[model samples]
Target: MSHISTINPATETTLETYTLMSMQAATDKVEACHDAFLKWRLKTHDERANYLKRIADGLRDRAEDIALLMTKETGKLLQDGKMEVELCAQILEYTAKNGPSILADEERAHSAGSKKGWVTYSPIGVIYSIQPWNFPLYQPIRVLASNLMAGNGVILKHASICTGSGLLLQEICNDAGLPENLFQVLVIDHDISDKIIEHERVRAVTMTGSDTAGRHIGHVAAKALKKTVLELGSNDAFLVLEDADIELAVKTCVEGRLFNNGETCVSAKRFVITDKVYDAFKEAFVKQMQAIKMGSPENEETQLGPLSSKDQFETVSEQVSKSVEAGAKLLCGGNPTDQTGYYYPATVLENCLPGTPAYDDEIFGPVASLIRAKDDEDAMRIANDSRYGLGGGIFSQDEDKAFRLARDHFDTGMVRINSFGAADPNMPFGGVKDSGYGREHGGFGMKEFVNAKAIYLP
Candidate 1:
């Protein structure tokens, strides 16, 4: 076993070291998981449910320690990390409560004199889940819990920055009495990810990462004839109509953009406001942006944490500078502080034009670009102009108009009317267009890792 060192992205500090599974080791683990699945899948639904429940209990029991570890590893606020731990437990419990039923066989009547038809859900062998660092625990657990409960062994390739969280998950599973290798975490270098994905024992791949990475993984999986589910990056739009509640819209916008220090893939990247309320919305939005507290994530009072890494901080900072050079006006917080960590204040940019870099790009930091819309038509046009159609929101007082805009105009997988785009355990979450394909939560998420087989008997 090779040793892997964990480094804190914030302070470039060494946190801990653990033995990592090599490519050969990961391949062996996948084969072991495949062999284990023969008996694991044969187990009764009640048994599977018990295992999931135990995993949830373990997560809940160690929530504090896990949360702190996640904070140190990913630089998220401790409170947010704690909430993520709780959410991960809830997801596992939800899967335990719902997975068996969702996978229950369905019977259907066939044509006259034909064989009866039926559909059943079955595990798709070993599934490779490539997760991001943003939601270290929640993202991986969301897939792991459901896949494991469905009797599919999972192979996780978590971001290098969050390896500690990944190991913690494996520990939780072990404590829950899950078989070794059933939910293996591969610690191989990033270069070897594609080789593991191509392994014969791996039947499918699920990834949540950059669009470029998604496309690359998607291509390899497609060539191998393997099923894939991808949750790519997004440049989501938050449209506020003329009749929208200005105060409410502004508050939600702030919360949406600044949430996770604006590191979320679903965070609203573009703000399209109607002329009627543009001034008011911009004023309130900028004021709230300025008021956000940015410091050490360990501090309970810190509203915004450092960017996950120096690369991210520099990326967003450069985008802000280039946007200003292209005539976009910086209302607040465009400069990076001289602080120790990668801390840039919540930024607001206005008068953004089409040719600017920030106009079409996804700014993955506490930077909000304001685009003025002449009316609802312009708002829709601006929202749909992007290549990305992930999660988007429309703020409008008129119910009919909001519904119409969301249903007819918005080009996204998940749309929110009168609310910023959010996800829940019960809702299906994914996106359209360049945002990549496939859903990741609720019943839809469970199906991503399984194979739906139809049976007919004559």
Candidate 2:
């Protein structure tokens, strides 16, 4: 237990072993990051932005190798790995291009518009980032790019499964001429992680994971009087209205459900269809789900890959089994293949009632939950029934109506109309309720941990 072994989930082979660092060593790294921040904060916003662009270039230069390492460690499709790397670079470039204005000091009117004043965003100290393994590069880059632009040092404690990805990220940043110790990666367990939050130097924390874990981290950081941003996962619902384009609905649902091997946080997990089009949507969705070929991540033609780990595989399988025991009906897949890897087939479950895992929980796999609604109104109601509000989607031939519905009715943070997506560097990311609070991306993340000081002159 003292050493963490990285495994290739597809082949179930150990790729490398990393020893957990002592508490003293971990704290030293944190202290060093704080030292780096002192000098980093002295740099102008434009100076930090230049560093961000250089880091973006470094990511592209090594995209192939980083993507391959990601695929070997997490069972993500190689092509998807390449896309993730590109997405991360795009985020950095976007931040660099827009950061100067976003973080710029602005003149203001004060004393009832009779005097001059200004507002400035000054950097805090080290910010700790705890990210998941699903999108190893994208997750950390989103946090690192914005914070570094805001002149704050960052320390990432990546998911244990993607430790190598985290270390490689640090090297890339350094190679781009980032100031020494501006970014560091920690290879430690949860016990040491808690202590890191309690460290006197780490100014704020950001984590993306389950609500259960979010609560624990929130409580720990709160006791220390530190601000934290939590992006807990969601069981997003994609609704098919009565007038929805049946063809569009089917295609979008299939792609949304199976993307990232169906382990995405904002990916569609529940399908709520209006009774009028329920039959047609269900038939087409099931046929497409069954047609997907599950195979090795290295295969170019493979549509589905293994889950991230054996424990994740067992968790999804058990959720399906218990959902059936609690009255859910299975439509296509309910069992694992005889393959050597931890591969689960594209699964569908209907008759999903309340109090069952299929209806109430976020199943982090390629399983889709179907629920019937009386009409479009009922479908909207069903979509908002869960405690999560990360993101959702609506499929309809009436684009205007769909836009209005998404803008006015959907209870989630982000909504897709007649289509599907993962993340956008230009849009605000994060969610509400148990899906966690606060926002990232766009211009919001640049100010999340910054000290917004107000200055006045009379």
Candidate 3:
């Protein structure tokens, strides 16, 4: 049997290793989870909500340990990991408190007469969730919490680097009184994962990762006629308008770009600043980027941590190098010191052009792309000029104008007007174009893998 090793990026050491399960064993897990779903679906929404509440409590009780593990495995800051745990717990509680009302039957009128009709949401079977290591626990929980509330079983195939986090999450759910096999983790490789998508017992699939990987999973599932929900990568833009408060925009943009060590899909990456404030924003932004402390994720004072792995570090470094070669100017913090571990300091690139990685693709690290816009109109135009549309931000002192732009003109799935975005339970998540489709959070996720049946009554 082959083995998977979980690495600590901060130390470049192996924390633990596990043997990958054989195909037969993995198939058995899918079957078992589907069996659990059969019985689970018969329970009322309130019963499911009670179980969800228990799971939320369990997450809180174990937040410290879980957050520490995340820091070791993924190199995200310990504080961010803790906040992620809280966000995950909140997602569970939100689903529990609001799911019954969201999924309750709705009355309608029959087409032929004034007779009453109703629609019911019935749970499907198993959901195969493929998640990335960046948000580890939070990534899978978003899918798991809602699907369990909708009465569906969930099988997880987390990123190979975060296998430990995946197992821990599954254990937490079962320990919190969720029935056996209702949620399972598959510790196999991609080969088996593809076959599992075609598994008869697996009814749907959901994934959060880069668009390249998301495309492959989505294709395999589509071939088997399975539904897919993918939350892919983005080169999200943050606009600094002419009327923007310079310091506010600078502070918020720095926080947005560097959060999660700059590995977030929706974090500000492209800085589209109007020419009027371009010089001021660049000067302040460069100073802030340079001042950020890059060191151990365990240090509370360390403002930036290493990339998730050596491979991630190499990728970000290479992208920056290529962008510089393509005529982008390195404003500050582009050099790598002799630091141990996979550390890459905060870097900024300006005059980022159309064809370079900085302007075109998601860098997935602490590198910012600065683009000078002619004016506010040009800033909005440039923000929309990407293949990705997951999320974007607008900074303007004119609150009404920013809101209007976000509401009517920002071509992304979600937007922030004069602020930054972290996924919220009360709002919908996911994106458009190459960022992939399908919505989570709010009440939409609970219904994604369910059958909405319309019934006509006498």
Candidate 4:
């Protein structure tokens, strides 16, 4: 059997290696997961909730070890790794607390006057999730927690870099009282993954990755007529309105751009500032970005860490160079540091044109793109001009106005007002346009892979 080596992105060293499951073995896993789903779906939501709560407890119990492992595997900051564990725990708890009602049958009105109608949510077979390396645990947990509560079995094909994290998570769930084979990790390559998607036992697919990956998965699943929920990449815009507070905007923007070493799908990437506050916001934002400390993710004092791998480092470096070549002004930090590891400094670029990567593409690293707008209306316009609409934010002193803009004008799946946050368990998260489709969390995910059967009684 072929083997896959796990590399520690921070140190560029091999951490562990696992033999890839053969295609036959992958098919066997699908059958096992489907069998588990048949039994698991018979359990009531409350019964399944117990397992979720225990899973949360298991996460907390192993939080330290899991966080450290993830930091070593993905190069996310140590603190961020811990927070990811907490977020995973919170997702489990949230689904446990709210899932019963979310999945409960709903009484419906019949088209004909005399009949009583109702709708029931029933679990399908296995759901295959393809997740990325960033936010390793939370990404899978976001899908698994809701599916488990909904009585569906889960299978994960995590990014190669985070295979260890995926295996460990499956182990934790099993140890926390999840039935064997209910959630399996497929340690296989893309070819085998594609075959698994076509397996009759695998009912649905969900993915959190780049736009290109999303397209490929969506196509493969579509060919099989399988349901897909993809949370793809985004160049989410953070609009600074004319009346925005410069200090608050600068601080929040800096935090948003550099969080997770600037490798988040929904983090604020494009800064569209109204001309009134453009110079002030840019000056302060660049200063804060420059002041960030870059070093090992293990260092608590380091605000920025290396990209997840050498490939990512090269991609970000190349994107910056191409953007600068395309006439974008490099305000600060356009170069990689001399330090070892896949390290890139906090970078700020201005005068980003429409065609360059800085303005149009998702720069998945510690680089900020600044765009000037004529006014508040123009800033809103600029924010909506992107092909991606995963999540965006508005920075203004007037909360009511910002809320209106987000609610009415922002064309994204999730919106933030004067703040920076990747996700919350209470909110529905996903994206629009090239960012892919379907929603997770806020009670929506529990129903995604379920069969919503409508019944009529006379």
Candidate 5:
């Protein structure tokens, strides 16, 4: 009978505790979800869509409570928590509205004659999702909403730190008329998680976490011959061309780096700027990063909150130190306060070298790395010089040129022009290389785990 403590990152206090589920219980729950999926899969697309709409409604109805719970569980701003709920609701509604068509059988013309062929998307059973703590609601909802709409049951093995948020979501879905066990939350350890992934009833697995974890899970699932969709680590490079608007680049880059307390996988971690505007952009960016207020997440005036956990704080702090030791100059905020909470000030690093963690690794905190590019060509080159490619952005006045660069040159899976955002329900998200594979959102998620059967008429 093991247990996990949910500690509030901002206060370093225990918020709640959850008992670990035994192996037998976990097995039973998987069986239950599989049973539910059999019934759920028999429902028509429109019938399933109704449940999704109600889930969206339920989220809106409990938005305030949900936001507060999320903020307490993960030290994100209250405003951001509320926004996460809204985003979850949007995902639900979007999936409900577009899922039917996206998963509908497509009619195709085959051969040289007028013979017709078709491809039908069929629902798979339970999809086991392993999500991280950042954006507790949005991360799980990103997968759950789309999968549910696709007529698959889901089992969530959320980050231990955000267990409460995970269970709350399950309660909301059930309250909204989701069939019992269609969405279940498993409070289990890594051992149980591995076992669950290998469970026969679990049709597919999806994960959002570090590259290391992604590799391990991908390997295990692969060994079991199970399909996986992994959205892993990233050191997203935001390029500022010489022709870029300094004001816009500075503002957007700061928001991109510090959003979600700088815990996002798609956050702008590296700033690759052309020499012509390097100094100007660096100065303005450092000023904004330095000015961020570090206080209670509940305070509207506070711009930066504590790291999600003490371990995260230590990781960011150590990375900054090693980078500085390896010749990276600390432009600002190298020291974290000896405070009660796991607070690390917004930091900016310059003279980032290739071998150092500051330049190579993803600094998952309020730290920004500035890289001076020889020119616009070099900026784009530097942006692609990484093993990871989750998301990146370009800041330039030339919208058409930026679009071409993003479409043709950016090596990442998702890109932004002149602005920054984690995700959009209407656009495909996920990445390549060490960032892992598969796409989510924009109706693409609806087809990830489903079978695309080819029906050919000769």
Candidate 6:
């Protein structure tokens, strides 16, 4: 057994130690999960839902403690972390309430008065879920709730920075009476992630991480002929039309870019504003970005927290530096804090060129890049130019035009009109292009862990 050390991203101090699972041990655990799936998946949907409900209850009861641990581990605001925990519970409850119906048999009529045909949703055996640290609780919950309620076992390989959150999730499942090995956390090194993916027991894999990691995992899963879902990177564009409510657009842009200190995969990374509203939007946006508090995530008054790790901080910093060198003006913030941890101030860049590093790169920190456009057509062109097509937002007072732009032009899998992009329990969430290939959260999320089998009567 290898020992895993947990560190606080805020202080760069050791927080806890855990026994990391070896490759052989991980294989054993996966085998156990496969065995448990045999029994667990055989249970009635209602029975499985009861287990999910118990997990939700546990999460709700310990929301505060879980939130604090999330903040300490991932360097997100305590309030945001608390919201993440609550959202996790909500996801579990939503899955428990809706999974049965979504997975129920669908009946279809025969063509010439023949027998009726039906399609059934069945469990897909063991799943390997690779989650990131940004939304530590919510990201894993999005996979775990849907899979468990759909009668599949999950083996989570969460980011090293958020191991505490992963362990807590395991504890919650065990405490909620989930059978042994039904849901396990593998505290293994990143180098061995591919080895764990190659386990024969894993039928499918899901990941929410960088594009590079997604490509590597997708390759491994493809070689094994297993199904894979990748929620990769995003350079989501936030477009502001000339007719948009300037205040609303600015507010949404600021909130979207700075939320989670701009560590979110779907956060608005690029701003494409029409020439008419460009100057006004920038002025208001810069002010809001500057007003946001930057301090410890635990403080109630704090709105921004440290980046999750030193590597992430440095990468984002380097990207900003290159963007400036490439001719973008630093409107507000462009420097990291001198204090401990990976803290960086909320930053905004203007006049960023299309091909610059900041323009195309996904900066996973509190930084926003602005791009000017001549009109809606130019805005659409700018938005669709990137390789990423995750979540995007379009702001305009003309509902018809906004709707048309969202339906016809936005390259992302999800688009929000006049509001910041978000995922709800009822709606589907995923992305197109290099952003990834799988859907998580909502009805689609449940189906990702299940196999749809067609049954026909002869």
Regions of candidate 1 where Cα sits further than 4 Å from its true position: 1-4, 18-20
- Residues 51-165 of candidate 6: C-alpha lDDT, one tens digit per residue: 9899999999899999999898889999988887877888888989988888888997676757788888999899999999988888888998899888899999998878989
RMSD of each: 1.7, 0.8, 0.9, 1.0, 1.2, 1.4
Of 3 and 6, the candidate ahead on TM-score is 3
Q: Residue 271: error of model 1 in Å? A: 0.7
Error of 2 at 62 (Å): 0.8
Query: Could you give candidate 2's per-residue lDDT for residues 1-458 as a string of tens digits?
Result: 68999899999999999999989999999999999999999999889989999999999999999999998889999999999999999999999999999999999999999999999999999999989999989999999999999999999999999999999999999999999998999999999999999999999999999999899999999999999999998999999999999998999999999999999999899999999999999999999999999899988999999999999999999999999999999999988867788899999999999998999999999999999999999999999999999999999889999999999999888999989999999999988889998889987898999999999988
Better of 1 and 6 by TM-score: 6
Pairs of colliding residues, candidate 6? none
Give the alpha-carbon lDDT of every model.
0.86, 0.94, 0.94, 0.93, 0.92, 0.88
- lDDT, candidate 1, 1-458, per-residue tens: 36767666668788988776667787888898898887788876668989988998999899989988988887889899988888888887888888888888888767774668888788878889999999999889888887887788898989878898998899989999998778888888766788888889899999998888999999999989899998988888999998999988999999899888898989988999999999999988998889898888888999998888877888988889999999999899887768677888899999988877678888888889899999989999999998888888999889898998888879998888777745688888899988999887787787777668888877
Model 6 ranges with Cα > 4 A deviation: 1-3, 110-113
Question: 1 or 2, which is superior by TM-score?
Answer: 2
Candidate 4 residue runs with Cα over 4 Å from true position: none
TM-scores for all candidates: the values are 0.96, 0.99, 0.99, 0.98, 0.98, 0.97
Q: Which lDDT tens digits does candidate 3 get at residues 144-256?
A: 98998899999999998998899999888889989999999999989999999999999999999999999999999999999999999999999999999999999999999
Error of 1 at 42 (Å): 0.9
Predicted structure 2: lDDT = 0.94
How many backbone clashes does every candidate have?
Answer: 0, 0, 0, 0, 0, 0
User: Over the stretch 1-458, how does candidate 4's per-residue lDDT look in tens digits?
Assistant: 49988788778899999999999999898899998889999999999999999999999999999999899998999999999999999999999999999899999878665668999998887999999999889999999999999889999999989889999999899899899999999999999999998888889999999899989999999999999999999999999999998999999999999989999998889999999999999888988888999888999999998899888989999999999999999999987757668888999999999999999999999999999999999999999999999999999999999999999999999889989998889999999999999999899999899999988887
